[model samples]
Target: MQVDALTLSKFQGAAEPNERLPMKVLGQDDFLQLLVEQMRNQDPLAPVQDTEFIAQMAQFTSLEQSRQMSDDMKLLRAQASFQQGVDLLNKEVTVQVGEEEPPITGTATELEMVDGEPKLLINGVFYALQDVIHVKAMDGSNESQSKE
Candidate 1:
């Protein structure tokens, strides 16, 4: 989510090394470079264990899989939210457009398609699903409020 060009540029400098996360994507080449650096700087007597390297690779794989799953879940959640909003049409809505409090007396009308997306149309005005602040039933009951 965070990309910095200056941080990436510093990676090309041999005199200074980055002390934080590198802005550029770390690929196989970067991994090989890091491995070489670690081998050169490792203790001469006590070296890194093979198990440690295997464990690190396993951890990296797990982290990548988790990130992919998290991204998929986010997309699914967004789709579900959109579907829920679209389904709210025909349900009375009470939204404050400009503070006039006119209440735009009308039942949930058909959803209008704009730019390939559905939007709720109430009282001849099309409103985005995200803009609907409140929904009221047409039965005129104060306690019949439902949250979408």
Candidate 2:
């Protein structure tokens, strides 16, 4: 008996024509399942060598580690971005909203996460952290004078 490799088309067969298919990357579980199936269906007369099985197990372990590292890096990046946004709070900032439009300058009032990315609220508008061009501490004297 021969086993066929899994493909994305197999998963999309029941979907509507107009619907979009999500891209799926095979992870550790999928890899382990394939390895188990291969072992179960191997020829009795020509059994797989011990070294080959060991090699496959090693490969699976490496794949799992790589996936974990990727997840950790993504989390680290998000935290760093959020920290940068927090540091900007209550500070005056200059941001470029568009190429043709003039830069907007305002005090960073709030920090929010939009679509899993950090955004800084300024003058009732949300701007991405990357768009910020300059940052300065608000003057204490000016704030006190304005209160009167």
Candidate 3:
């Protein structure tokens, strides 16, 4: 019988009770089931030894552990990349807000950093991530004049 990827994944160990129908993760049960099935269908004179079974199980365990570790590492890397992107955007001089290209006008009032994102307080109005465009630091002279 030919088992496709989807079919193989859903099949719990043939040795495992029906109550334990679905295997949570690829594990020893699956390996044992495959081994049992192979022996059951093998020639009457030919049998797989215990040593071979142990070796195969060891190899499967190592492979499964490595796969799980690699998946975790990938998730960490993705999170780090996302954080770096956010940092770069926070330090940017300009930001694209949606498809609406509002003309770059008005002076920035208060510089607000919300959720690690820098948003401009423009024309005494607060802007969100999708509202602001050009953002620059106010010169000391401009700040002084504005204060006056």
Q: Rate the local accuracy (lDDT) of all candidates.
A: 0.66, 0.82, 0.56
Worst 10 residues of 3 by lDDT: 139-148
Note the residue pairs that clash in candidate 1. Answer: none
Per-residue alpha-carbon lDDT of candidate 3 for residues 1-148, written as tens digits (9 for 90 to 100): 6786546666854443345455577666777898889878877777777788789878998998998899999778656644533432323234345566644445544555555455555455545544544444444232111100
What lDDT tens digits, residue by residue, belong to model 1 across residues 1-148?
Answer: 4547666666766334445755566655666687778878989899998787788678767877887899999778667766866666667776555555644545667776565455677788886665566666556554344432
Candidate 2 C-alpha lDDT tens digits along 40-136: 9999999999899899889888888998999999999999999989988998877887788888889999999987899999999999998888777
TM-score of each: 0.51, 0.77, 0.40
The order by descending lDDT is: 2, 1, 3
Q: Which ten residues in a row have the lowest lDDT in candidate 2?
A: 139-148
The prediction achieving the highest lDDT against the true structure is: 2
Better of 1 and 2 by TM-score: 2
